[model samples]
Target chain A: MEKKQSKLSIVTNGLLHENPNLRLVLGTCPTLAITTSVFNSIGMGLAATFVLIFSNMAISACRKIIPDKVRIPAFITIIAGFVTVVMMLVQAFVQPLYQALGVYLPLIVVNCIILGRAEMFASKNGVLDSALDGLGMGIGFTLTLTAMGFIRELLGAGTLFGIQILPDAVEPMAILASPPGGFFVFGVLMALAIMLDEKQGRKVDADPEKIGCAGCPNSKNCHGEGGCE
Target chain B: MLVKSSPHIRDNSSTQKIMLDVILALCPAILASAIIFGLRALLVIAVTVVSCVVFEYLYCRLMKKPNPIADLSAVVTGILLAFNLPSTLPLWMAVIGAFVSIVIAKQLFGGLGHNFANPAIVGRIVLAVSFAGRMTAYAYPEVTNGVAALAGATPLVATRNADLPLLTLFLGTHGGVLGETCAAALLLGGIWLVVRRVISPVIPVTYLATVAVISLLAGQEPLVQLLSGGLMLGAIFMATDYVTSPYTLTGKLVYGLGLGIITCAIRFWATSAEGVSYAILLMNLLVPYINDLTRQKPLGGGKRK
Candidate 1:
């Protein structure tokens, strides 16, 4: 059905238009900490995306049976199961990343991205749509995490995934690895995201009251709408 | 018939009134430092205050705007900024800090509540980074039987690594800024502010708790961390700056917790033994966001994160 196809669109749109990490700003701690290296970023991103998809699928399947009173608890329990699985697998196989993401690995349960998608999307959507939504959001988070990691590692350590980018003469700012630097980097990136959104005619926060030049008689009443005159 | 508004009550509080109380509250610390550190401390405080007021006045005049110096907020910033610096810092550097605080941090950012970080802390950090030698240059006053300590590592530096006597740190025997040496004095000022309702305990108390818990975990003496360096001054005064801190009680608690956690981490593990100023500045930067996130809507209002 056309309705079903559009429903699927909602799931896929999150990959860029409504990305959980980049666009919506969910789960920032992992974005800041694990993004110190590209490898770690990919690892953390894939891990989080896996959790998000599974949690969304489970939450979607259980939506009808879940009581409104305890929906949050139910969703959290489902998300926690996937997060635990991710943690065990990462520790067993990816030992370096496991160590780098200490405490944050367990903290995935508190990540707003998975929980937000589960509550906002999976709670109302069908199983297939929910799974796609999870996949889209998960990949979006992964891409952002990888980008952040690439940047921090490239500048802070002068290497991208252990490859030297900058010369040895250039000294990296020690603060880049610290928490304050993490916040600064994240703030700048968010500002950049907002600027990019504007450039692409997304109009995420457009005011409906304002009239464009098309509605004006002489084009003098432009209403600052892209200087249409 | 005139339509009456739903709410008719108006409180006695204003931004100017709160800023005035802050100025008055810092007086005891300023006077105590002047008495203990002698003419130099008084000179430094006077120059810092006058320069801040002048800079603020001239900035507004040049910009063709109404002057904000009448409210004495610049005076409070000057006094607080002086308190953070070593008494031995050259008067010119202190003046530069005043200019940075008022012109760059305050006015350039649209004044008062507009700044993302505390102006004084930013000024201090600027001096700390740019003129580390002068900023860290401390001079112990001539007291009975003991030689005056010169510019060197602070008690926090010593305490960060080894066990320091709580009593020595509690009193003003350690090496730090003139105002920061005595925990009792800072506490007295904090208590006065609280008694006068100049500042709420939400920030100071929460920030202290965060630092205490983190330091305890990091194998540092909790009491020593509390008493050493600028922790008390930062918690009591700088962190509680009305314009740069969270408005709601829960938001303040969260901000304070973040400050304390970061401060303790820096003190115990990072290169700097003192992290209070940096931590407070960082939290001050987050205040607006916290206010936004924790903004409680009117009863039965719209809900969003």
Candidate 2:
């Protein structure tokens, strides 16, 4: 007899409780490196989703046939095949996006989120559950990446998907457009997410114990508990 | 109930203390600048410090917050800000920089360690954009002559426009900001800060190495690049800022290297000559993720993956 978790749980889990980007913090390189615009985020997210879905299905189908001893290698091979296909398709049709994303497009092959899902959930679950998990996770990642893209592009460049969202009089915060700005936005958003979760009477994922450099020399006598907040 | 109430040893370190230590370590550079630029340096420093402190005080009071200026953080910020600017910088510019550094960069982001980018760098960049000619225009101290020296190009300006002598740049005879004019003094201050345990050595060493390597690769004078402009000041002070810099040793090295590489690229290739400020500001934005990736609790002590 199979015990069932409702599908709503699967979707909501990705949205917050089990968010791949915020909670697990997987796919961070792409999240930080390529999210300079809404288009980039959408492109990265869709490409990753496609890879995730196919990889999840392939891994689940061959889970039993593949030996446990070499499961990691087997998983890598499957992921590589899907990623190669994604690369060619992007190069052919979405060349602009492929150019914008650069190396990060191919890096999706090793993205921790896809690999993490394959190792933890896809391998053990039935094909349907695995498919749902991939879809939920894919959507969650797409939304988060897009949100980050929206904030970075809107504030950094005064554009979202290349459309101006702010008045001309307002000076853009140029730092938000650069790599350091990306991390700053990422931290603030992550902190806000935790705060909102707590306010909504949900279990917040933020652990002050784990938020920063805890034992760092600077942390000991600086900023109350850490050097700086 | 367990009885244990006698005078227990409390850690003497505090944000205020660390900030004060950094200011003290920076005193040499500040004093050196006062000597070089004379009363002009003192006036600029005073304006910067007072404006930064006043702005922070007013903002906190307006925001209905506790007086954060008591921590002496704004004081440190002011000193660092003055270090980056030319000693002959107009009083209005320094005051404007104070407002921007305190209000926009520091207070807007919730103050102190919460700012994403270093406040001093932000203020410098704003000044650079608003007054490009003034920001880059440099002047030598008028010690021999009675009259104040007119504006002249720094070694970096010379390097960009017409490559200058490396030795002259190193010796600080060339035109530049007050403190940045003396590479030797900045190095001494950096060493003092490191020895005092005020800042780690990773950032300064790695940042310098990266810039040196990149400069060599680009067929430029590595020594000149190392000694010119704000590279020393940025690497030693701004890049090592606790709130904006990475924490772990590995992360700090990576952060420093990244800053150096970015700085070299901007200086040699890009149009901007003030590369240090931009590079450190960019690295500051990356601090959180750097700490996240590098901060590993002891094995068996770590939270679940």
Residue range A1-229, candidate 2, lDDT tens digits: 1357787776566776567887667888999998889999999999998888889989998899989999999998999999999999999998899899999988898999998889877888778777788888898899889999999899778898898889976556666778867876787677666666667676543445765654322222233444244
Where's the lowest-lDDT run of ten residues in candidate 2 chain A?
A215-224
Off by over 4 Å in 2: A1-4, A88-92, A164-175, A200-229, B1-67, B82-152, B159-305
Segments in model 1 whose C-alpha atoms lie over 4 Å from true places: A1-229, B1-7, B147-151, B161-164
Q: Give per-residue CA lDDT, model 2, range B177-287, as digits (tens).
A: 767877777888888889889898988999999999988999888888899988988888888888888889889888988998899888878877668888887888888
DockQ of every candidate: 0.04, 0.05
What TM-scores do the predictions have? Answer: 0.58, 0.57
Local distance difference test, each candidate: 0.79, 0.81
Task: Give every collision pair in model 2.
Answer: A180-B285, A219-A227
**Shift of residue B36 alpha carbon in model 2, Å:** 12
Quote the lDDT for B8 in model 1: 71
Which model scores highest in lDDT?
2
